[model samples]
Target: MTVQDKLKQVAESLGVPFVFEDWTLANVEIDRTPLPAVVYVLPASGELDFKNGNIRDNQNGMLAFLDKVELNGNGQDNDSVVDRMKSLAMRFIVKLNETGYFELLGGVMKYQVAYNKLNAVTSGIVFDVTLKEVTGICERNL
Candidate 1:
């Protein structure tokens, strides 16, 4: 499976919406009514460097953004959105740690507050992820 596919799988396993390939946000309909979503974006194209004979290292930089709309106009705190974002990000990290197939170099979860198209307050988290692909070595006997 591809790296994108694996990441999406991890997100789905945690019961969170996952988007990777084409139109990462197109799956949802964002009309006047706001919705919560977890979107994965590939900010830079992945780099494939030769590691050894017939082996290559694929490095991909990704960002996972958690979007939550504040429907209530009571000046609600962003605690809920922050919690959800942290939970999902933690799960992703755990999954990656368990699997030797990927490496989590380092990342930071940045809290953001912005206005949506409907002028609604949106609070979310953006996780900057640096991922490295795992290489497999095969032994052949003649």
Candidate 2:
């Protein structure tokens, strides 16, 4: 199965949709070494460098989705779940940036939302958001 399909599978099993409707990017550096500096290193600074950025689509409600996700060390209190989500969501952002798969690609997106509901014994959650275009110049994989 494709990567998107795998993500969907994970979400379905968890009773959520694999929706990355919004967008963001960060952690950029030039990599003359031919690999991202974050995961690898270069002898010289400019020889291999990198930088990070984001598209900021935020339609499926970036804030809300982030607010709902949970984290390991974060609080599990009634008021802390949102913070946990934000923290966990940031990890994806960091990973995307470190791998050089994300960067600003200017575009317009009003709102983008995706959701799955389970009304039987649990409540389905939804997120509202917009879209943002992102681009990349894959260093390791093209």
Question: Which candidate achieves the best lDDT against the true structure?
Answer: 1
Q: Say which candidate scores most in TM-score.
A: 1
Residue-level lDDT of model 2, residues 64-90, one tens digit each, is 232222223323342354444434334
Residue pairs with clashing backbones, model 1: none
Q: Worst lDDT window (10 residues) for model 2?
A: 35-44
lDDT, model 1: 0.54
> CA shift at 31, candidate 1, in angstroms?
6.8
Compute the lDDT of residue 2 as modeled in candidate 1.
Answer: 65
**Cα deviation in Å at residue 38, candidate 2?**
23
Candidate 2 — which residues are off by over 4 angstroms? 1-76, 104-142
Across 1-142, the per-residue lDDT of candidate 1 in tens digits comes to 5676777777667666665532334333323223454555654656664455434346445544455555763435566666666676667778766766676544554434333422335555555565666753322310
What candidate 1 gets wrong by more than 4 Å, as runs, is 21-37, 65-67, 72-75, 106-122, 136-142
